[model samples]
Target: ALAVGVAAAALLGFAVALTVTGLDGPEARRAAAPPGPAAAGAASRPAGAPDTDPDGAGTLREGDSGPAVSELQQRLLRVPDVYRDGATDGHYDAVLRAAVARFQLWYGIRGDESGVYGDDTRRDLESRTVR
Candidate 1:
């Protein structure tokens, strides 16, 4: 329990530092690399449904299943404010929606950030992924 808390705190601290210091710096990109196929400066879309969203991240929403949701949760967890354990269960539940809202608010991607996981949200969220 202690280890988990410590790790979470450290990650959150690092996240805050990155946000405050500006991710435009190369060091921030290497430090927060998200799991994906893309390389540096490239889009990290998880590769799923068609590119309906302007950001082309995807168009998943609540009740959706599979790897995309899992990926989204994993990225949300990195934000630190999501703060929900077991987020990568591959279920688009309420917990995920709330987290998505937080992410949307953080990135200013409004419209339907209510766990809808639409293209706009996906685009903003996907940009955070470390491919």
Candidate 2:
């Protein structure tokens, strides 16, 4: 009787092990990028936050002008490493928030969505750009 009980316990343990092992899938293992500060909180930051470029030195190129997003910027919206969601239509909305989060995550900066791309974010973007 005791032997039968031990065998049943072993079988149960093996089944459980198999079940747990089988649960590993692409969805389960999606390598989520590190999270940034909450978007809502970051957006309303005080005027004089710790900024990289307070003087507005980094001007957007021809396509980067206006609230309208550029193609390159749109491409950035798709990069998983960049952490944006949905389309990059140049409006500084949630997608841009995610992009800023990605930028902050990559550069190890404290996330603050001041809407102005600071020197650190710009520098990191410049360094990572593929010519």
| Best prediction by TM-score | 1
- TM-scores for all predictions: 0.51, 0.39
* Residues 52-122, model 2: lDDT tens digits: 33424553322244443454465465456674445545555555555665666766754234333555655
In model 1, the worst 10-residue window by lDDT is 49-58
Please identify model 1 stretches exceeding 4 Å from their true place.
1-57, 111-113
Best model number under lDDT: 1
User: Candidate 2 lDDT (Cα, whole model)?
Assistant: 0.54
Global CA lDDT of candidate 1, please? 0.73
TM for candidate 2 is: 0.39
Across 1-131, the per-residue lDDT of candidate 1 in tens digits comes to 99999999999998998899877678888778874553532454455634445433567777888998888888888776653574688888777877887777777887664657887776666687766
Please list the residue runs of candidate 2 whose C-alpha ends up more than 4 Å from where it truly belongs after superposition: 1-55, 59-68, 110-116
